[model samples]
Target: MESHERIQAACDFLLQSPPGEINDVLNDVRNIISDDELLQEGIVPALKRYNLAQFITVDVPETNHQSIISEAARLSTGSEDEESQERWLDPRSKKSFVFDHIALEASDPQPFEPNEDFETFRVALEKASLNYLLAHFHDGVSSAFSNQTTPNQFILQVVANKYNPTNFWSGRWRSEYIVDLNDHTIKGTILVNVHYYEQGNVQLSTTHSISIALPPAIVTASPESAGTKILALIETEEGKYQNSLNDTYHEMSEKTFKSLRRALPMTRSKLDWEKVLGYKLGAELSSSKGAFTSGFS
Candidate 1:
């Protein structure tokens, strides 16, 4: 496949995986940018864009290569340029030679001090860094999703209420599961819910119940797994645009979806959905990890 397609696939895969799997992401990056352009253009540019090159400090002073090349070619076919600008060897490989030049240029590199205010340069650098990091982060996320090795299940729940006695209300539900390939262990799940209002007066509403159960291994692994399971159960049953009892709800929960759009490095950082639900239901778990109940007053 083309580079863009490969990148896209990797991203879709990462949505199901974790970002901490760096090796897998790097491999996917290699596939997206082959050896020819990968090193010079793709990898180099990506690193620079992400400010990694700055951190690595790849700059150094120029070296006099005239005598070194002359000595190496005492009886060889290689020739040195007048000022040794064109080609030179220092017992380092050809790649190292290029690397040295890049480092030299980067080291003490000229800053864009075009008589602008201090904040200007700071803002520009921040924007550029953000752009590069975002692109690389996206690619990394995709690669992580594709390398998932866990098995999972999804469950959804929908709940709705109407204040008036005669009006109709709607609710939508959705859920997703990332399944592990090895040992059929569940990795994670994303859940969503939505509520819609109608014009007429109505009171009382129905709730669609859903229950998802992961294997014992997955449930006991970490809190993230537990959160994913809870999300799946709630998302499976959301509100329908309109309910005639037998009618299907094509719409899924979309509210607050973007709030959780940020990516985490691993499943262990997944939100504690149990605490959230517990607070919602007002359960009396005093000893619970009530992180989710802090500001819900």
Candidate 2:
């Protein structure tokens, strides 16, 4: 029989056999089709059609060696001299080598969306949104702290008060998640608008926008396995959540104070400062962490 006909017969036999017998049938077929070239030309397409591409490797040739070398040389030297670059650009040059034995592992030929179930996609988006929100809050706090003047207790108190974790815990922010089916990414954003009266005359406002991109692991995982993987990630980070919250709050307090110094320079030491800012911040962070955990769970 022709190589193609034999491969087709093997595929048909395997499809009709019980699931437990597939491995035996595959081994038998592999023994019969001993030639790698014949197997690539005949059996590879059949395996892909059966969703068994992962079981085989096919040798494919790389035809663009000249382009690859030219591009590499151009990038390495950052040079545009055409005459000096002709050696690497010539395909027939004896100095150039062709990568003819490129072996490609079989992968799912279908698009990523079809491989993923909707539930996994939704879970990935939720995770992405939560991560974005927390990261944004953390960065804002860090930025505020880094820009503040040291040893200024009044500024620290003012910043802590203005960025109270309650603002986030109270659900006053806007967030949205988008699943890009084509690109296999979960994109999310968290937005917060802060408006405060500084010195009783000027109203200061700023908008904080945080964005995140999540991988396609959850979406591409089998429905039965995706939830377990997500749970594992959360459990791994559970113990550190509260500590992270506290550190973020500390940084935010410093940042807020710096902003206040620039906006209300004369009132920095004159404003009625809250004496128990530390206690209030701790309580707010604890509350915010609880809210975040509950939402993620």
Candidate 3:
């Protein structure tokens, strides 16, 4: 069948079928297309037309905490490269440390365009994934200490508070697409990991991973409303993390995680898939223009 015809058939099936038969109807659409690439391109838009984007599987499967820590450490110490380090001295400890922050984002500019195809979606997903990795290294000097020291004092406060035992901290933000076109569902994940150090040793680590299921209707819905719903889901996940950690850690980890939550931004901007899709391949994509803001100071 022609691509448009197949899409129309899928839409017609969805419109007439009951909720319980969604899976069967989706499977039939896959069978009719019989091409992974073509199905990914054509059927997805059809699903969106029918308000079924949520059923797509978009996610970031690999989130390596150890890698995040190692990259943050490398950036902080400037061992990997001196130019990458942003040095600062702690006021209380009088010790120099590096503060690095990274953000990862992915987008597609014309995801909803009639001519949008699997290649466009695949490119967007690949770009987002690369950003997820590069986010670990795209460090910037923290604003909190940017103006603290002059040529005379030469010392900058590292930790947010004087009483805190941690002398250094680093944070990374990541967002990616894990699209399973074969399954007829779309999904995404947002990750935030923060590490605290004292005397160059990690004292505490806190992480938040948010899984988002985008409904097909989202493609046609208001971007603002869609973003708000996604952020709400993220906040809900944050609450779950707090509850899960409540009984596990009664002291430092608990206290530090709570403080980190307060420091992080709770709101996010609307995601522009079209712009994200237009990014260059293998480039260090910046999330500053994406939905969420950097939570680390």
**Model 3: lowest-lDDT 10 consecutive positions:** 152-161
Give each model's clash number: 41, 3, 26
Give the range where candidate 1 is weakest over 10 consecutive residues by summed lDDT.
139-148
Give the Å error, residue 246, model 2. Answer: 7.2
The CA lDDT at 231 in model 1 is: 37
lDDT of 2: 0.35
TM-score of each: 0.17, 0.23, 0.25
Cα distance off (Å), candidate 3, residue 10? 54
Residue 248's C-alpha lDDT in candidate 2?
A: 69
Candidate 2, residues 1-297, lDDT tens digits: the string is 987788778767555432223355667877887776765566544443432211111211233211122121111123444322222211111122222111222112111121122434334433443343354333211000100121211000001112333332211222223334345432333333333323332222223332223357764666345434543443333324435646766886789666666454475654335756876888999999999999999
Error of 2 at 188 (Å): 1.7
lDDT by residue for model 3 (1-297), tens: 678787777667764433223455777877877776766656543453332211211111122111111111121334644523433322112133333221111112111111223333323332333333244234211111111212111111011111222435544333333333234233444334344554554433344444445566643344344334433443455457657756667764668676776443355454455776565532445555343445543
Q: Best candidate per lDDT, number?
A: 3
Ranking by TM-score: 3, 2, 1
In candidate 2, residue 151 scores what lDDT? 23
lDDT of 1 by residue, 1-297 (tens): 776565545444433222123235556656655654533343433432222211112222243221111211112124433222232222111111322222323122111211122223223322332343254222111001112121232111111111221333332222222333234443332222222336543222333333334566545544444444433332333223224333432222233433556654476476677687866666555534475467563
Best by TM-score: 3
Give the Cα-based TM-score of candidate 3 against the true structure: 0.25
